[model samples]
Target: MSIADRRRAQGFTQEGFAFAVGVDRRTVGRWETGKSSPQPPQRPRVAEVLQMDLDELDALLTSTGARPKPVRSAPSAYYGSGDPDEMIRREFLRLMALSGVIAAIPDDEAEALEGSGDDFGRMNGHLWQVYQLARTKGSVYPVVQSQLTALNDALREGRAQAGTLCFAAGDLFQLAGELAFDANRYHDAAASYSLAASASKEIGAYDLWSCALIRSAYVDLSERRYRRAADTLGFARRIALRGDGSLATRHWAAAVQAEAFAWLGDFGACEEALDEAEKVASLSGQGSNGRWLRFDGSRLAEERGARYLQLNRLDLAETALKDALTLAPLAAGHSFRRRGAVLVDLAAIGAKRRDSEQVMQYGLEALRLARISGSGYVARRLRAMTVELGNLGRDRHIAELKAEIGTLAA
Candidate 1:
């Protein structure tokens, strides 16, 4: 007999069964209709309500043909299991495939799920907080992966509203993209951002959609694909214009555009974009939730400094980077990464000026922080700085600093 048949034979109405199971009536309806099965935590309670053992409950749940497939083994971590890079990549790929499964279901059937989107919004908000507060970003991967799995099951079983699912998918995909990006998996980051953009567009979420495009542009920017990055940023800028102007989305797009222009060696265009980014200072609110839509002009100093440094404007770069260092938060992991980046830029300036003492002073400190934080972003900056030291005439201190940095990869 089906679950509903057993429940009714036991003289329990759907509402009564749901009440005893501590779930919503709609959730019971979904199980009865073969749309979804009980999660592991809910199984024992469900079995008790239907007067069955664990084995009988499993059989009943499986009879619906809605059981989730067993998880596949992930790729071996080349960097070791404890390495944040490997952990982030493995979790990101696993969740990406799971979350993408929602696209397989037909739209109309998917929309039939009962709950409002508020539950998902709240859960995502909490996850974002945990992400921002974590020491290592990879530490948040397990929770995010779990959330994605739950969302996937809900979407597959037609237990969530379609519009809500789209919004959640867009948000979750962006978060996944960030993890992939931090892990230096640029291709995976680009794919996740593309999925986010698609889902945001489906729901007319202009800000979310534009942010996805902006993030996708970063993948191109990192690879030194300046022209492609510029083109993508241009599209993002136009999309952000249609969003709430009171928000910082447009300015964030412009700020990132400045970086592209800097890389392209267009000093004039770069400055123009920087000026446009400064408009965020005049806005009323902080213009961000410190989560998905972060753009309060706090990073502008560092970004401007980085861009000017790219343009060989050492004086301007130093001044801006100093300001960023002063404003950066104290003793936070994120601050360590940010401060390490600015210090590396300063060290690069010292290298260009052929000042060995200045190079050692800044470079060694940045390298120490990179090792402490395990930040790939900071490590990459230090590697580039090492290449710049070749022009410094083989100074012993510079060589020592390079040797120290080499130990990071080991």
Candidate 2:
């Protein structure tokens, strides 16, 4: 969407949106008409006022054939170039699915590279979406490496939009860390997450920073360091609180915290966190967008089921997992990873009860899904069921299930 289109959709008049961007209404007119582009330092505010990520803002500017050109020669002339509209600084992003959070960018860092920062942000977001959809994660490495190199060079050379570039870099770092996590490279993932958190902190991107911390918690969780994971989640929850209230930043953190708390056997804390996560359903907006915020309560049921399973509450886990299975996202097989995880959980319940038939039924289906989707997450869950499978060995099917899980690829 172009700037005008996005502005109107977000319920902003030219004068109103541009007014918040600290630019003249005439400047917006020129931008939409492809006559002029916002100067570098002003682009961030423009993007924020439009209630969009830097990538989306770039789309609007680039769509109109507008290009940013830093006005280094004159300062007074630029500020007095034209009159802007009267608009409140109340963030429009709350309307953009990110609750009442407004970013406070240094009026200066919005202008760094000509189009590189936006390009990086856009490409990084696209790569994350692609990564989420792809079964095998390794294929995205080449492109990620290339983009990382270019972005790093740009970061060093670019000066004005330091914060913008850093945010884009942070987004890219998270994606890179996700890839490392998928490959089971825990150390590398931690490093990438650290970089992500640092970069995001530079820009005061509460959501982004919190997300990095959440991912870091996953590393500790994978290592069976429950205490460390809980600590990390505790920090993430605090960071998320500083972000836009409309976004699901805090809720997502709560969800993860719920999982961590469950692992710690803190039943009260887990329930409290789960209740907080469920509140996402009451939000007026989706509480997410094309950026890093993907928690919209769509997977809340599955999340609840997983938490219950962690706490060994089989009845609750079974009910919630079954409910999750009936949901469209799982029923239609939109996400094999999620579906497979649920199946594995169900199989674990069956194993706990010494129900061979039930174990074989859900376990086999989960194994099949793992093969079809090549999801390491599902594979890991399937492999974790080995201890449960050890409790039952009278049936040949149980032995086969254990063997298959052992042979699953990393």
Candidate topping TM-score: 1
Task: Flag regions of model 2 displaced more than 4 Å.
Answer: 1-117, 329-333
lDDT of 2 at 314: 91
Q: For every model shown, what is its TM-score relative to the native structure? A: 0.72, 0.71
Question: Which lDDT values do the candidates have, in the order given?
Answer: 0.74, 0.71
lDDT of 2 by residue, 132-227 (tens): 777766567657756766665565555325556667767877887776676554655777788778767766777888999999999888778888
For model 1, residues 158-244, the per-residue Cα lDDT tens digits are 676665777787787788777656655565577678877877776667788889999999889877789999989989999988766
Candidate 1 residue pairs in backbone clash: none
Backbone clash count for every predicted candidate, in the order shown: 0, 7
